[model samples]
Target chain A: MTTDLTDSILYLDAVSVSFDGFKALNDLSFVVGRGELRAIIGPNGAGKTTMMDVVTGKTRPDKGAVVFDGSVDLTTQDESAIASLGIGRKFQKPTVFDYQTVEDNLLLAVEGPRTAFSSLFGWRSKVTAYQIYEALSIIRLGDLKYRLAGSLSHGQKQWLEIGMLLAQNPKLLLVDEPVAGMTDAETEETARLLTSIAGEHAVVVVEHDMSFVRALDCKVTCLHEGTVLAEGTIDSVSANDRVIDVYLGR
Target chain B: MIKFLFHRFDKTAAYFIAALAVLGVLIPILNLALPEASTFHIPTYLVSLWGKYLAYALLALALDLVWGYCGILSLGHGAFFALGGYAMGMYLMRQIGSRGVYADPILPDFMVFLNWKELPITWYFFDHFVYAIAMVILVPSLLALIFGWFAFRSRVTGVYLSIITQSLTYALLLAFFRNDMGFGGNNGLTDFKDILGFSIQAPTTRAILFSITALMLALGFIVARAMVASRFGQVLASIRDAESRTRFLGYRVENYKLMVFVVSAAMAGIAGALYVPQVGIINPSEFAPANSIEAVIWVAVGGRGTLIGAAIGAVLVNFAKTWLTGTFPDFWLYGLGALFIGVTLFLPKGIIGTLTARFNSGGKGDTA
Candidate 1:
């Protein structure tokens, strides 16, 4: 029961969501601290993505409320406004602007605070484009900056999307399946990317790749039937009976 | 950087294309000075007729703003256009005043002919062109806001959204056709004596109208360009590419879509208002779904996602249609349909798109 008072960045009360007589998220509650890496793993239909959706304003919860930065009520705000409050999301499929170059994709993602409009008149300003370049370099995408996003390989696209998220400079990042279909090396690299960014920003990555999750060695949250089934280190969660049943097909 | 904008246009045969557009605008003006029956004599009717096509080009640009960049295919845009036209038409009808044949001064001649006792209360203040201009832009904007609010917030999309939009215009077509609707019914509000005291039939007036059309087209381009370069356009692009994903990315997807949708409708409205004055007609035919579909074809033929391409497509297709129908009246639809099919299959990006692609490839992007 050691709740870190100084670091909590997000607080989700007993939140729930129902769609057409089915419960997608059932009374889930959790807290994420500032600059922490949280990975959510679960069986299919475990509502992991739905939880992310709720946090990011894609899905509205039927009950309960969310607080961000310890004060901002996130329940009523629109996605853009919520995003303005410093939340960024990367989809499972890595939705970058396909027709745009990697550089353009990052340029388009400069959102929330000093987003697309402010940058135009100030694009050549030394600090801003430099920041974009730095984000690209952080994702190791600086070499392929001129390539169209659609031309990127799967792992690269994932990294590009992560770079886009990084370009947004959100305080909390909700990344879904960051390495869903990557090679072993790509998966390892992605884990490293998350780890590198974790100390400066809180990251919530939803993935099924155990090795990737193990590699990051972050807090593990196992979800089942839309609620937390277990929460601990990867080793302890894997040994839990309920988590084993859900992950190993009972 | 405008790097995208410059690259997009520079490689798209912009020089030749621009020359043709300038020709399209000037021909109607140049034909005005020709003698009535001389070899160079061009009919005034033809000039106005071509002007109508330019108005349609404006509509295509408006539609492209939403449909091309935002992925919102509004089948009901015709309704908004007609609404603006009707607003202006109301002002025009009021301007007829005591000068009308019936001389009731209060009611338009059609209202008096239909045995209406007095002017419809809503018909007040429309006698002024200033009011007409305001209404032309305002009416479409209001209608778009209300309709878009309901349609988008409710999460209506794809074919369902299309059907609703279709029904909206169809409903307007029905409402405006009534003799008691105060819009002159099927005959519509025509026989315009003046637009702010200028004889609309005069060649000078014609030239002014033509130039205004060109100016409006240019302004429309600039405004659309500015918007697309803004954060507004990025949201629209995201909506086009991955709407659901955008929603999760913290965009109020519906608000962005709705705002652009309303703005697009207002642009269409302005186009329609300008159209009525030049063409000397405002009728329910403007509400026809086929007309809207033709507008879509104009955008599609030019390029679905390209803003200026839509305007170019509108002028070129209508110009071609005029030429084709005049020569081969029997097979115009076949030619038009074939043109659409050919563009779709062979050049899915439209003429500007295909040309730009080649241009970019020529520049050597060096695909990995």
Candidate 2:
């Protein structure tokens, strides 16, 4: 119930979600402390992505509650509200603005309070720009900022999407399979980038790459059938009985 | 932030855009001033006609907000336009005062002709230009809000959403066609009357209407341009391309759609209100589904997402309509159809949209 950090950022207690008749998440209790890096690994349909969905306000948990910033009840909030509250999510597939420049795509992720009624005057600011470039540096796409996001390579596209998440300045980031489709070098670099950002923000990376997970070298939690099966260091979780049977055992 | 702002401005082609806007205003003025004696007296009505065209341009601009950016192709824009026109028409009817054939003193000519007892409840505010103008914008926006909230929250999109919009407009057309509606019914609202105590038929009045139309279009252009340039605009584009992904990226895609849709409708309403006095009539024809469909053509012809391009398309197509109807009457519809197909196929981005493609381009085809 209590997150161990200077400021408890995200906490989900007994969160469960059902789609149609099937339970995507069941009695899941977890807390991501401020600046903590946690890797979530599970087999296909272990509800890893579903869990992220609930946390991001994409999917409302049928039961239990998700609390952020110690007091903000996430269950009643929507996705944009959650994001505006400083939580970002990167999907498995990169979704950058294709027609926009790499820099523009990253810049678009920068948050501002522009509403439909008042936006007729247009939004103009300089602070958001600096944050965009700073994020591009972290993902190492600063040089190709002028190139179209559509023209970027697959790895670069993935990196650009990650950089976009960074621009949002989320206190908590839920990244799904950052290395899902990348070369060994790209995957290694992604692990390093996520690791580096972990010091400033809580990161829940759902990655299948065991080596990349080991590279993260953070607490690992294994989920089976919508519930956490094991949790600990990679060496400890990898050796757990059920964790070996459902996932990573292969 | 300067770099970011500049980058988006450039992406939106805000540089040469000022020049195009100047051309948009000047060309009409020059055309109107040119001495000519044609069968249609084209120059005499050119300003007012073009003013209405500019209003249509604003409608196209509004369409771009939802369809071009947010990926919602509403087929009910005409309904919103007509409702605003109806509100303005009420004001015009009120302005009629005792100037009617019967000189009933209190009622509009139609109401006197219809043998109504007194003015309807909603007719109370038409006497106040300010309230009427405010309703011109507010009414459509509220309708859009209610409709969008239900449709989007229920997850209706694509062709289904388009169908719903068409149905919405069709329903409005039917309702407005009724005499008991207190609108003009089948005859609609039209007469020789004053707008603000000045004879609407005067040359000076026409010039003023044209100027107002131009200013409104310019305002629409600036606002629409700024919106598509902002962070919210980016979220809207993201929603257009991939709603589910945007949701995962921590955006309530429907709320964004609802917000922009309502704003766009209000813009269309303003366009329709300006259109009434210029065109000299506000009929139920304004609510026709075909009118809304033609709006889509205007947007597609100019460029769907490009706000200025939509404006360009509205003006150009209407200009062509005037000429084509004069020259070949029956063939205008065929020509209009051909034009739509040609734009969708050959230019894809419409004229201005294609010309700017070399600078700011997307994937190979239309996102629609």
Candidate 3:
């Protein structure tokens, strides 16, 4: 629990955020090492999503330090700025550019100059094309690359969203409920995909499915009342009396 | 350039440009080269009227760029158009020197009538055609940049943005109506004598202006098409569909919106500049919010996102308005309202969108 903030790719120290009278995050602190994968499990209102929002700059923490890549303060940056700083986030619900082709969605997310001027003159370069193809293959969406994202099935859309993150090639990825509406087989495939992505980028996956968490086979953090209640291996965290009483309902 | 053109213009766009080109050359030839006795001859008055429609077409195209592609739904687009017209009108007013009814070389007739001792500083350098031309592009673009910066940065969107844009044009309408504003007050800028030393009422001038209007519409179409076809356009489409997703992808959404908004305003300004010379007047009525709403209708009826369709809708609607007003002036408003309701209920995609969808589906069925 006492990790060096400078040694981690993402360091969140004593972050707290409140909405009106409700505390979404209460003195939450955690460190994600470079290329490490962490699974967050909690009941409703445990602030798992709020923690992502704070780190991704969607919401400002009332008090805490969010440092990315060691020295960059994420609190002062906006969503686009934070994204450009090599932090990518996938929403709980699949959100893709519905009208655009799957390939164009990945193309838009591909790392490069994000200014209007650059986009105006942008053409598909060899490297970008290669990256897109690589992402498409990884997500098993290569054949549906030309199809409209809206037309894809729910699982396919989820994969396309993951593919978009891969195309971005961020140093850290925040994936929220990637398999929420997916089939069991699709969920297994997604677990495999996230495992493969872990060594190249730090991943913070927030999920509700214990089976899915076990499938990820990564370090588990159980949050309750806006703070971490347990942290250890999945077996240990699930075995904790407080985590089971509050979340598992044994 | 040839490769660029081929890549940018789809078949429909190519045909749209070709039609404009043919009309640009043919209409002038029919008016100027043929005698009035010949059936082929296009009367001077009709030429000017159609020229006005082409100008409206360009305005509608400008609106479509922001509303259809970017989902900005600007209801005050006429403000930019009217500003461009006023810029051209100021030059025309200056051109009337020594030839006006007041015959004042230093002041326009309206300024002289109001007994202004000196020309307003705003009117300075408007005497030069080059300055006026620069104002035509600059004035609207400047307004759009300032307006879009505030609106987009604040993330004002949907019907709320539409309401503000409507208020923007309405505010301009009121300001332009004030005589102290020195823009000819409620009467607006009129009494033009010439442009570039040619008689404004001359048939040759009318034909040339008509040709220019057609060319400008073609140019506007080409420019809009190029923007929407580029990766920039794809980003705009994404912003329209999923704005937050686009932001998460690292694009400065406000910057993209502002860029297109400014470009679209400039195009609308050019359309207004072309309109004034042919219409022989520029007035505060041009700034009426209703005028902007009608332009949006033209885009919607033709197909909101299709550049060619915007032009087609503008001409079609205006042509109908002319005929209906002449026959049943009292019923024109009702007719327009009914038409809009009918299009929304039966053809939500507008004329071009529905037709293209049908054609595409039919093609797919044949393959299947």
Q: Which candidate ranks first by DockQ, i.e. highest?
A: 3
Per-candidate DockQ vs. reference:
0.38, 0.29, 0.64
The weakest ten consecutive residues by lDDT in model 3 chain B span: B1-10
- In order of appearance, the predictions have TM-scores of 0.90, 0.86, 0.98
Clashing residue pairs in candidate 1 are A79-B250, A80-B250
Clashing pairs in 2: A126-B1
Point out the higher-scoring one by TM-score: 2 or 3.
3
- For residues B271-330, what per-residue lDDT tens digits would candidate 2 score against the true structure? 989899888788888889999999999999998887888888998999999999999999
**CAPRI quality of model 3:** medium
Model 2's DockQ score:
0.29
Put down candidate 1 lDDT per residue, B1-368, tens digits, no spaces. Answer: 46534433433345534654685566664677666776766566666776777778889989999888988887777777787778877776776678889887778889889998877877877887787788889888988889889988888988898888888899889988998788899999888777777777877676667667766776677667667765567667877887775665555778777778878888898888878877777989789987788888899999887777898899999999889889999888998899989998999999877776787788987644
**For residues B1-368, what per-residue lDDT tens digits would candidate 3 score against the true structure?**
44443575668887888999999999999999999899999999999999999999999999999999999999999999999999999999999999888888979989889999899999999999999999999999999999999999999999999999999999999999999999999999887889999999999999989999999999888888878988889999999999988998888999999999999999999999999999999999999999999999999999989887888999999999999999999999999999899989998999999898889888875211
Interface RMSD of each candidate, angstroms, one decimal = 4.5, 4.8, 2.8
Cα-based lDDT at residue A84, candidate 2 = 81
Cα miss at B163, model 1 (Å)? 2.2
**Of 2 and 3, which scores higher on DockQ?**
3
Cα RMSD for candidate 2? Answer: 4.4
